[model samples]
Target: MGLVLAAGAGRRLRPYTDTLPKALVPIDATTTVLDLTLANYAEVGITDVAIVVGYAADAIAGRVNDFQDRYGVTLELVPNDKALTWNNAYSLWCARDLLSQGVMLANGDTVHPASVQRTLLDARGEDRQIILALDTEKSLAEEEMKVIWTSENGVRTITKLMDPAEATGEYIGVTLIEPDAAAALTEALKLTWQRDPNLYYEDGYQLLADQGLRIDVAPIGKVDWVEIDNHDDLARAREIVCPS
Candidate 1:
C-alpha cells in the first residue's frame, strides 16, 4: 500500500493554494501533484493508496472517485482535523493504521518520476525497515531536508538545520516503511507531535533513528524533482513534469 502526506497548507504558494491543497495544485493543464503521485504509485503496482488530507480536504475528497478511476488505484482519504494548527507530524500520525501494511510513503507536494519510487522499493529488504530516498547528486541548500549518513551506521541525522557541507544528501520526501517498523514509527510520531506541534514527520524519523531503529538510505542518483512549497518551486515542478 501507499501513503501520502498532503495535509500541509501551502501558504507560500499563495492564490494557487488559497482554495486547493498543495497536492491538488495543478502542475499541468489537467494533472495535479496528486495525480502524478497516484500515477507513479500505480506504475509500480501499488494500487491501494491512502492520502492524509487537510487544508482543502473536500477538494481531494470530492475527486476520490475520479482519481481512482483515472489512476487505476483505490483512493482513501485520511482527515487531519489539526491540519490548520499543527504540522505534518500529526498529519502523518492520522494514518498510523495504514502503516502496519508496509507503506511506500510520499510527500504529496513533491513532483518526481516513478523511478524514485522504484528505487526505494528495489532497495527494500528483510533487514531494512525504513528506507529514505536520498538525492545525493543534488547540490545541498539550507532549506532542503539534509541527512548525515555513514555506510556503516545508516542515517545519523535528518533535519533541515544541518550544515549542507556536512550532509550526505537531501531526503527527497519519499520513504519505505516496513510493517515491522510501524509500531515504533507510530509511537515516535505521536511523541514528536505531542512534544512540538510544529515538528515535521522527518523529526519523527529522527526519533526513530535515535531509538536505534535501522534507518537506511537509497540514493536516487540524478533526477529532476521539486518540492512545491512556493511559486518558484511550483514553476520548477511544472518544468520538470510538463516542460514544452
Candidate 2:
C-alpha cells in the first residue's frame, strides 16, 4: 500500500494554500504534486493508496473520484482533524491502522519522477526494515531533512538536526516501510506525537533508530526532484517539472 501525508496547511506558501492544500498546487499547468505521486505508485503497479487529509480537506476530498479515475488507483482518505494545531507526526499517526501492511510513505507536497519509487522498491534486502529515498547529490541546506550516516553497510543516523556540513544526504520525504518495521515505526510515531504534537514524522524515524531499527537509505543520484514548501520552491518545481 502507498500512504501519502497531505495534512499540512503549508502556511509558508500563504496565498497559494489559502484555498488548496499544498498537494493540490500545480507544479505544471496540468499536474499537481499528488497527481504525480499517484502516478508514481501506479507506474510501480501499486493500486491501493491511502492519503491523510487535512487543511481544506474538501479540496482533495472533492476530487477523490477524479484522482482515482485519472490514476487508475484506489484512494482511501484518512482524515486528520487536528492538522491546523498539530504537526505531521499526528497526521501520520492517524493512519496507524494501516501500519501492519507494507507501505510506501510519501509526502504529498514533494514532486519526483516514478524512478524514485522504482529505485527504492527494486533494491533487494530482506533484513532492511525501512528504506528512505535520499538525494546524495543535492546541496545540503538547513531546510532540507539532512542525514548523517555511516554508509559502511547501509544508512545510519537518520535525522534532520545535524549541521548541513556534517550531513551525508538529504531525505527526500519518501520512505518504504516493510512489514517487519511497521509495528516499531507505528509505536515510535505514537511516542513522538504523545511527547510533542509539534514534532515531525522524521522524529519518529530517529526514535526507531535509537531503538536499533535499521532505516537504510537509497541515494537518488543526480535525480531531479523538489519539495514545494514556499514560493521559491514552487518556482524551482515548475522548472524541474517542465524543463526547457
Highest lDDT scorer: 1
Off by over 4 Å in 2: 152-155
How would you encode candidate 2's per-residue C-alpha lDDT over 23-130 as one tens digit per residue?
A: 998777788899999999999998999999999999999999999999999999999999999999889999988878989999998989989998889774868788
* Deviating ranges (above 4 Å) for candidate 1: none
Every model's TM-score: 0.98, 0.96
Q: Write the per-residue lDDT of candidate 1 for residues 147-234, one digit (tens) a residue.
A: 9998888998999998899999999999999999899999999999999999999999999888888799999988999999889999
Residue-pair clashes per candidate: 0, 0
Compared with the true structure, model 2 gives a TM-score of 0.96
